[model samples]
Target: MRLNIHTLIHPTIQKLAYEIIYQKSHKKLQNTDNEKTLGMLIFYEILRKWLKIDNIYIKKVDVLKERRLSNQLDKYLIITNIIECYNILADVQRILPEPYLKHIDFNNINNSFYCNEKLQEYRIIIFEKFLKNYGIIEIINYLQKNNQINLNHVKIICLTCNSNILKYLANKYPQLNIYTIKIN
Candidate 1:
């Protein structure tokens, strides 16, 4: 139940951010006035630096293939700045079940925090692709396995084009929020 800045962020991410921002590299961040806002920026920049430095990222770097990641990174940067809030998602992004949290926007993540149409659309793209690669069983397993809590506590996001799956999950867990592309 640790809840501090250091505990909230992973050591690797902290090191990457620190080294890139202050220690090894002399890169200037987008916002220097507020350190908290730098969390997401640094995470994205780590991806940038890895793309240039890491052997795997370098070899596997495909601009077209990583379009989904790039798209979310854009929204991540946008929402991080506009919302002025950073919590579990920033930490979870760098440290997660597999650090594959590209779909759920960190900003609008809350139990009662209804996602907007555009955000839902963005997530559907991510979820659909994920479902294609790894079937529903795997997706649910991953979602069910995650135990990290955001600032607003935490909740599992179930998205499906199948109304049957939605209904099944809803009836199974009434309190949980199961989202469709059309839901507000």
Candidate 2:
């Protein structure tokens, strides 16, 4: 089944929310020196539009009653979405680069180093979502089904934090030797 973009957008927003709030620490007014707020506002607006949430104006009194109240609300709405987006992006980031075991021509594996041009411009949100949901096994399966690789000879190197995923891969593809490295 095709992935829903709206489901993807929420997580992307959440990821950005963490980046903006925790990583950047916009608690102090000085942190707002750059266009960080503006960037966040734009992202919020995009998410609002995608989720079909109506825009509501916040009056000066409302803004004064709680400093950064708007930012806080945006953070809450986007956090879940950001987590989802990060997962997808991480997957794309993991596989899009050259020398993906399944994508490489095994005979020329030592020399081949090409990126998939078609996915080069994936939006950050979509890419993050892919990482969260699609693991090496799924990628290998996709390649095998698409005739990009022979499943019989495929070896999987999985660096995953999820033990359940490792167990699932072990059970599903016994023919393919799987080595997993623990990720914190």
Candidate 3:
């Protein structure tokens, strides 16, 4: 899927996923069956709360069957449950988008700067872990390192605990496009 910063879920759901991951880590749960069960519970609870429904539940087998059917029909499986969500997010440690230099040619310039640049229009730096002091250093470091690139085209993707600090950051770095993604 062509997911941007908007693909992230709500903050409450993100916190719940973090809690699930923390529990799984402490218990050393290695079985996918159990993981799926736990994931289902969270997913069901979120849906129930959001929809304002009571005691809504779905079987793991049914979910899997629907996923397969969706795949057969050439449709995207929207919800892969919380564990899959966490796994997908955890794997992506960093995403430094390519800089769209108006005049610079790639033939002479060093390509070491962005070996994994997927999107070229905007530079996106992702942080799966908690931000250091609300990501002030990271933002500054990115701007400094990519001083050759224009700040207006950059998109800083991070997970921050504080929304107020995020607002502050948005104001502080008006040149860059800062996006806070919530973990699902």
Candidate 4:
């Protein structure tokens, strides 16, 4: 008779497995038990696949006393918890449908792309159109409001794979220095 053992595992053990996969870090198994090693190896494989990273090597470190296990586990859990939160935020951003909502104005920053104060030295603008007006209006408005963007100050506008958008932006923002390239 075959018995399903997974259901018998404690909830904390299940959470350990999740952390092992999501944390993408080496786990120290103190006891060197067969079951524990097997679980860690499985977790390593899952992490490798999820991250799309190859050439990962897992080494078994010397185990500490049983009393120290709790402290080590606490450290691991803390690190993994932070990493999991960041991963969740990234996943949410990827799955979100609103691009405009993701947009952040950088005009106020001194060293941001939208800052016009430093345009005279050398600057590059990468253009792409997806939502509306090719997003050039947003950039132009950023520059216009900042009082720094000018044709004489701009060095190049790199337009990849969209000449029409480049032309439109050039016509609309005549004072913008621009260039175009078709990436194939």
Task: Predict model 4's lDDT versus the native.
Answer: 0.32
TM of each candidate vs. truth: 0.23, 0.26, 0.34, 0.28
Write candidate 2's Cα lDDT for 58-175 as tens digits.
Answer: 5685463323212221111111123323332223212222212113322233333233432222211111111123344444454445445434343332222244544555566544
Cα lDDT of all candidates, in order?
Answer: 0.30, 0.32, 0.37, 0.32
State, as a TM-score between 0 and 1, how close model 1 is to the true structure. 0.23
- lDDT accuracy of residue 116 in candidate 3: 27
Looking at model 4, the pairs that clash are none
Model 2 clash number: 20
lDDT of 1 at 9: 48
* Residues 40-149, model 1: lDDT tens digits: 44334334422222222223555423222322233221121222223323453442223323343332344322223343222121122001122333333333344221
Candidate 1 stretches greater than 4 Å from native: 1-126, 129-134, 146-160, 182-184
lDDT of candidate 3 over 64-120, digit per residue (tens):
322211112111112112222454332221211111222212123233233223233
Q: Per-residue lDDT for 50-144 in model 4, tens only?
A: 22212434455864333211111110000011221222223321222211111232222233333323433322232221112344555555655
Candidate 4 weakest ten by summed lDDT = 71-80
Local lDDT at 101 for model 4: 17
Residue 16, candidate 2: Cα error in Å is: 29
The best candidate by TM-score is 3
RMSD of each: 16.3, 18.9, 13.6, 21.3
